[model samples]
Target: MKADPQAQRRLLDLQAIDTALAQLAHRRRTLPEHAELDTLARELSALEDERVRAQVAVDDLDRDIARLERDIDQVRARKDKDQDRLTAGSGPARELEALQHELASLTRRQTELEDAELELMEQRETAQAALDQVTGRIDSTRQRRAEVEQTRERTLAEIASEEQFKTSARAPLANDLPADLVALYDKIRENSGGLAAALLRAGRCGGCRLELSATERGRIKAADPAEVVRCEDCRRIMVRTAESGL
Candidate 1:
């Protein structure tokens, strides 16, 4: 594809814009906040699971305590009735003695039940503290996520604006160049690592930085100035400049 010598130079400007656009796209994908947010989200899920387990632990303890309390109430009521029967003095000696012994047993059983309830209450307290800690951590993480999301959005907006600016900057240059040349460059760049044109500086292909042979230099020198020249090794469209040493 032949183009004016000046148009070949414009390809450099287009490449610079294209390179910036590519860098911007990469920056968008690799934003640090996105990774951090994802990590926090996973941690929050784990915390939620811990909280549920802790809650279940607390619930079980509560049920145990309630059963113990009911047992204590029944024992106390039985002891009261037996004590009243002993005081009434209507039973035989053996029956009264048996009633006294039963009352003693009931007292001991109540103490045991009360001790068990107390132990379980302590366990519940500890479990509740753990639950609070997990919930607090979850809340803290969610707060941080909100903050990071805002920052990420701000970063995205800045990138979007910069992309718009670069796109606007590239529009006229791309529009001013020959359609066929731009199309060819686009097609090649798709498979050429976003670099379709290379400056032939110091008898070297700027894309690959390999020096051209004397024969290659001779051919380029003999070619028409308007004819498109390509690098022998890199296959990039070569553009000559004052510093190109062509």
Candidate 2:
């Protein structure tokens, strides 16, 4: 492909813009906030699981306490009925003595049930505290995640603006070059590593950092100034300048 000597030099400028755009894209993908958000998401998931377990424990304790209270009420009611019968003196002496013994047993049973209920209540309190703690941690982690998301969004917006600016700058510069030259550069860039045109400095291919063979350098030296030269090793357009040392 043939392009003006000056147009070939300006190709380097286009390459610089393309390189900057590529770097910005990489920066956008590698923003630190993305990793932080991922960490926060995992933390929240684990905390939510812990919270569910704690809630289940509290609920189980609640059911146990309710059942124990019912048992205690029934025992108290039975003891009350027996005491009333003894006070009324409505039974034989033996029967009254048996009623007294039964009353004693009911009293012991009530005490035991009351003690068990107390222990269950304590357990419930502990379980409730644990549930609250896990819930609080989840809320904190969610808040942190929101903050990180905001940071990530802000960074993305900044990168987008930079990209827009670079793209706008690239349009006119690329338009100014010959269409065939730009097409050739684009085709090579697609196959290469986003670097189609590079300076031939100190008799080296800047794209591959390889020195040109003596014959290759001689050919380029003899070629017309407007001729588009490609690196033999890497097939990148070699733009010559005074620093090329050709």
Candidate 3:
């Protein structure tokens, strides 16, 4: 397409800006902070689940201890009443003998309750330890999460500022170029992984880094200024200048 050389050069500048912007966007997406945040989030979730389970275990042990205490109390009270009856002379020998036997059974029952209480205490302590560990992990994860968030925000802001600068820099070229040409440039940029225009620098194509033959350079120089020329190596639109050393 016929376009002023200056306008074409401006287009190249716009292309370069857009290419840099794309790289910035890709970097932002692949930032380590993003992965770090994800890892922190997963760790936090697992810690929360573990904490909850530990708390539940502690609660269950508490209930079990309470129930065992109540049982022991009831059994001891019954044994005390039986002993009182036997000592008060209010029962026959057989009845007193039965009361003593009941008291011995109550003692065994109390021992069992005590053992259960001990086990429950141990379980409670273990649960508490697990809870503490999980809480510590949660705190650490939260701190890391905050750090990741801050880093992500900062990086995003920098990228935004850079993109804004590139957008403003491309503004001057937008008015002079036709919409169809701009679309074509954008398509080529997408297909070329963000490089749409390349400078013919030092007799070489900047995009492909391949030297242009003398005959090819002569033909490129002889072409009309309005004519757009492509590099033989990469097929990218080539913008020539004195720096090209053709």
lDDT of 1 by residue, 164-223 (tens): 999999999999999998998888788789998888899888888999999999999888
What are the runs in model 3 whose C-alpha is more than 4 Å off?
Answer: 177-183
lDDT of 2: 0.95
Q: Each model's TM-score, in the order given? A: 0.93, 0.94, 0.88
Global Cα RMSD, each model: 1.7, 1.5, 2.3
lDDT (Cα) of model 3: 0.84
- Best-matching candidate per lDDT: 2
Better of 2 and 3 by TM-score: 2
lDDT of 3 by residue, 35-127 (tens): 888888888888899889988988888898899989989988898888789789786888888888888888898898889899889988988
Clash tally for model 1:
0
Point to the candidate with the largest TM-score: 2
Instruction: For candidate 2, write residues 3-102 as lDDT tens digits.
Output: 8999999999999999999999999989999889888988988998899999999999999999999999999999999999999989799999999999
Better of 1 and 2 by lDDT: 2
Backbone clashes in model 2, listed as residue pairs: none
